[model samples]
Target: MPELTTRIGDLTMRSPVMLASGTVGYGPEYEGVIDFGATGAIVTKTITVEPREGNAPPRLVETPGGLLNAIGLENVGLERFLAEKLPEAAPLPVPIVASVAGTGAGQFAQLAAAVGERDEVAAIELNISCPNVERPRNPVWSDPVAVGEIVSAAREATGKTLSLKLSPNTSDILSVAEAAERAGADALTVANTLPGMRIDIERRRPALGNVTGGLSGRALMPVNLALVWKVAEHVSIPVIGSGGIGDTGDALEFLAAGAVAVQVGTALFATPEAPSEIADGLRNYMEENGFASIDELVGMAREERRTCAETA
Candidate 1:
């Protein structure tokens, strides 16, 4: 069998497929639904310093090719997560990546220091790009300078792998990505979700209670894939692509685009077995194609593009 091992900085995963944050609740919500063994790691819902009630009702709207959500990072507070959720997740065979967001850079450092001290947690994913919040302050990932400050502070506070989850809603994504890398980010999650809204003609109002929401699913593939390719090429850190990955083909596309790993999100809402199915498909494909490991498949498209460019 081919080796499916993938490395995101010093953190090594058994497979390249990971369950995205917010999709799976604190790890117990999907008990009988999906097999945890199929995935390399699982990122808990984005936890904050305090428990969040989240946005108003009607937090989700089904769009044509995607799902719009304004869930607002509803999660257990830091204390509860560390005291309860983390221990509950410790029994799972896979690695646990704690997804966290703070009101500011200092809070991020504090949260990282607390979470990183736990033995059960394998890595820290900074959700600095979430667009669903009410915005008492500007999002950290929106500005390159703030991104640097937050990432730097968190890096200093944690010894575990730090993956900066970036946003695509910015003017220059490349600059933001470079800034995170310079601030000591071990890895980068290419993106979160696109800001979009659907109008309710019948109600003469917005479909989501939050008025605006983040879009996910197949529709996000093209744009996010391009971003993953660009950011992966520009930064030296590992890139974990998260967007519209629904199947093996979608995951393969992200890997080819230069992502070291792919996070399965919206797919889990409907097809809970997607991560395992995709992982199986990837293994079969690698065996058939004579590729020994995920590293060989990563960035194949970029290398092809480079060769084509040189030839042209």
Candidate 2:
């Protein structure tokens, strides 16, 4: 069998397919619905310093090919997560990557230190790109300097492997990615959901209560794939691609494009077992194609492109 093990810094994942944050609701929600051992990791919902009520009703609106969500980072506070949520997730077979978002560098550092200390948490993902909340300061992922500051602060606070979840909303994602790499991020989760909205024509109001929400699903795959490719080309750290991935083919595309791993989010809403199924498919594909490991498949598309350009 082809080796499915994937490593991001010091952390190792059994498979390249992981459950994206906010989709699986920690690790216990899908106990019977999906196989936890099949996936590489589980990124829990974005936790804040305090518990959030989240946006008002109508938090989700289905578009033609994607889901627009304004969940507003609703999650249990750090204390509860450590005491309750983390303990509940203890039985999960894979590593637990705690996702966190905060208002500033200090807050991010605080959250990172708090969660990074827990034995249940294997890694820390700094969610600096959540679109639902309104903040007085600019979004951290948009500015390279801010990205450096936030990532650096979190980096200092955590001994655990740190992955920075970036945003696609910015103009120059490569610069931001490079900044994160320089700031000591172990890995980068390329490109979060795109900002979008829909209108309820009858009511003449926005479909989502938050007016604007992040767009995610099949529609986001191509866009994020390009970002992953570009960012991977520009950075040395591993990149974990996330956006729209429903099956093995989608996962393969991201891996070939230069991602070490792929995260499945919106697809879980429709197929809870997608990560496991995709992992199996990946193994089957590698075996049939004679690929030795996931590393051999990673960045194949980029290599092909480089070869073509050289020949041309």
Candidate 3:
């Protein structure tokens, strides 16, 4: 059997299929519905320093190929997460990756430190660039300087593995990835949801409460794969490909493009069992292909391109 286990920084994941933040609702929501053992890790919803009620109603709308959500990082505050949610998540079989977002670098540092203090958390994923909020704050990942500062602060606050989630809305993703790398990020979640919106013609208003929201689903697979390929070429740290992974094939595309792991997000809304099914499919595909480990598949596409170029 192929070795499905992989490492991101110091944390070892049994599989490379993680449930993306905000999709799984703190790891325990799908307990009996899905097998937790099959997933690499469960990243909790992005938590904030204070409880946010999130935006007004109509926060989500279904689009042609994806979902547009403006949830606004609504979650139980840090205190509630630590006191209530963490305990519930601690008993799960897979590792817990706490996802956090904050208004500023200082708040981000505080959130990271608080989450890191928990023995159950295996890693921290920094949500530095959510696009659905109504606030006028600048995204930390959009500027290399801000990326470095925020990542540095979080790095200092957490001893656990740190994974920085970058925004697709940024002009130069490579520069932001490099900034995160230089600031001591252990891993990079190549890209987040793209900014998008829809209007209700009948109501004469925006489809989402926040007016615009982040888009995620099948449409983002190619975009996310390109990002993974590009970031993998420049950064030495592991890259966790995210955005639109929906099945084994989608996940394999990311692996072939050079992501060490992949996160399944929008798919879970439709099929709760998607993650485990993809993991099983991966194992079967690896064995059938005579690959002894998942690592062999990582960056295979890049190698093929290099070989073709050399021949030419």
Candidate 4:
């Protein structure tokens, strides 16, 4: 059997397939439906300092190739997550990556510290790409300076693995990514979701209550692959490719593009068993390709192409 285990900083994942934040709820909800051990890690929904009710109804809508959502980071808050959610998640077979979001740097630092103190938590994924909030006047991921500040604050607060989730809406994502790495990020989640909107022609109103939402699904695969390739080339830290991964092939594309791991999001809506299935497929692919470990496959495409060009 091929070695599927992967490491991000001090944390190690059994597999490179993680459940994307917000897609799998907090963890307990998918208990019977999916086998936790088959996955690398479970990233909880984005949690805030205080409980949030989220946006009004019509927050989710289906588009031609993706799902648009404006969930507004509805969560049970830090208190409930640690007291209620984390305890339930602690016993799961995989490591728990707490996904957190805050309107400001201080809040992010506080949230990171609280979650990092827990033994059950293996890493922290900062959701800085949320489109529903506008508290900073500018999105955190849009500005390299802001990204560095938030990442630096969180780095000071936690000794655990810290992964900053970037946004595709930025003008130059590479600059923002480099900023986070310099600020001490342990890993980088290649992206969150892209800005999108829908309209109900009949009603002559927006399909989502928030008017604009974040897009995720099959359509995002290519976009995220490019990001993983770009960031992986520039940063030394592991990159977790997220966006639209629906199967083993999609996941492999990310690994080939230099991502150490892949996060499955919108696919869960249609195939709750997608993660395990992809894991199985990944193993099969490795065995067939004579790969003894996943490390051999990570960024193989780039290396092979470079070699070809050098010889040519």
Candidate 5:
């Protein structure tokens, strides 16, 4: 197989296709189905300072073309993860990226330090877009300054590859992307989930136990691609494209939109083996198209779209 070689910041990955966080759990969750080694890397679920029991029952609801999840950032916390999950994932064939979320900058840093202290962790995927931000206003990822603060703190605490997972539901994603880059983030994961509410009109109440949930799947592809394209074009750092990516074609779209690499999410719920299959399909597509590196596709559609717009 010709290598779909790509780089996320300074770190080079075997392929441009990878698994997104939250959906993949701890990577071991799908051990029964697909081969973990075949993936570019496994991004672990978001871990906080303490264990999160997650949202109440009926946490997931499938929409017309997507699903809404009110998982409430459920995680085993960083300490336990280091003592328990890290040891198990440490020996995996592919790189194990430890993901962490926080209520404030300090907690993100604390989690980063806790996980970074471990030699087993290959990299850090900071979950900045998680919407469990409680109180009057406490979204660490929403504000660009807050995002920068978290990234700087995480960077200070670890020498591992630093990636900040962003939320697409923002006024200016480019500003946030630039903020993360200025704060020393090595890479940016474009988009976490769009904030959407699902109400059970029959019951005259909210569908999810938490009332609101994070949106993912095919419905989000266009929005996600837009964010990735904008952020990638706005910044020099590598961007990891995600959201609504279920097949090889979707992954290719993200690549052409300026994403150095792409991540598969939500799709894992139905097709556990989608990652490997998509990876294989991408390899075949690239080979058939006479492409050498995945980087060849970045900003491709943008130029054509711009030219068409000018003529119009």
Candidate 6:
């Protein structure tokens, strides 16, 4: 059998297969179907300083190739998560990454510090895409300066990996990525759901109760892959490609785009075992291709395309 181990900074994932934040809920939802230990890691939904009730009814709308959701970072909040959720989920066999978001810099840093103290947490992923109630005009993540300051501040609180999850809606993703990299981020989960809204023509209202929602699934594939490829080209740290990753080949595409690993998102709604299935497929692919490891597939397409062009 070929090696499937993947290195994401100092952490080595058994395979580059991980569950994306939000999609997999609080990690216990997949109990009967998925063997939790099979995945390299599991990133829970984005946690906040306080528990969120989330948006009102009609929060989900099924599109042709994707899902629209305005979950509004609903969770048990930091204290509750630490006290209740983590204790239950921590006993699982694999590494646990607590996905977190804060109302501001201080709030984020404090939350990171608290989670950092936990031996069960392998990392804290700062969600930068969340809309800011304070600054409704400007996106907090669009500016690299803020990204730098936030990640740096969080570093002071915890040493467990510091990762910033960047949005795909930015004007220059490379700039945002560069900012995070320069800010000393250990890893980056590229391309959170783009800010989107779908109209409910029949009801003469918005599809989601929040009016606007995050779009995931096949619709996000192309745009998200572009972000991953660009960030992988520009940033030095590990990149976790996400958004619309449904199958093993789609996961492979992200690796080809320069990601160290790929997170399976929307696929969870239908298939809980998708992550493990992709892992097995990747191992098979590596063996058939005569590659020594799954990591070898990272950016392989870049080199192959270049060679093809050169030969032409």
Residue-level lDDT for 125 in candidate 3: 96
Q: Which residue pairs in candidate 4 have backbone atoms (N, alpha carbon, C) closer than 3 angstroms, thus clashing? A: none
Candidate 4 lDDT by residue in tens digits, 1-312: 899999898888889999999999989898988878899998999999999999987999998889999998899999999999999988878899999998778999999999999999999999898888655667677899988999999999999999999998878999999999999999999889998999999999999999999999998889888989999999999999998999999999999898999999899889989999999999999999888887877897897655864586
TM-score of 4: 0.96
**lDDT (C-alpha, whole model) for all candidates:** 0.91, 0.92, 0.90, 0.91, 0.83, 0.84
Model 1: residue 84 alpha-carbon error in angstroms: 0.8
- Candidate 3, residues 110-212, lDDT tens digits: the string is 9999999999889999998788775455566678998898899998998889999988787789999999999999999978899999999999999988899
lDDT score, residue 54, model 1?
A: 93
Best by lDDT: 2
Q: What's every prediction's RMSD, in angstroms?
A: 2.2, 2.1, 2.1, 1.8, 3.1, 2.3
Name the runs in model 4 displaced over 4 angstroms.
135-137, 304-312
How many Å off is the CA of 81 in candidate 3?
Answer: 0.3
User: What is the total number of backbone clashes in candidate 4?
Assistant: 0
Error of 5 at 195 (Å): 1.0
Model 3, residue pairs in steric clash: none
TM-score of each: 0.96, 0.96, 0.96, 0.96, 0.93, 0.95
Candidate 5 lDDT, 1-312, residue by residue in tens:
456878775567787778889887887767767667668888898888899898887788888899988898888987789888888777777777888887778988888888887777778999878764453464556688888898898888888789999988778888788889998899999888887878899999989888888889999999999889888888888889999999988998998898888888898888888888888888898789776667666665788645754686
Which regions of candidate 2 are displaced past 4 Å?
304-312
Better of 2 and 4 by lDDT: 2
Candidate 4 yields a Cα-based lDDT of 0.91
Each model's backbone clash number? 0, 0, 0, 0, 0, 0
Question: Residue-wise lDDT of candidate 2 within 1-312, one digit each (tens)?
Answer: 799999988789889998999999988988988788899999999999999989997999998889999999999888899999999998878899999998888999999999999989899999999999996456677889988999999999989999999999988898899889999999999879999999999999999999999999999999999999899888989999998999999999999999999999999999988988999999999999888899988997887755864586
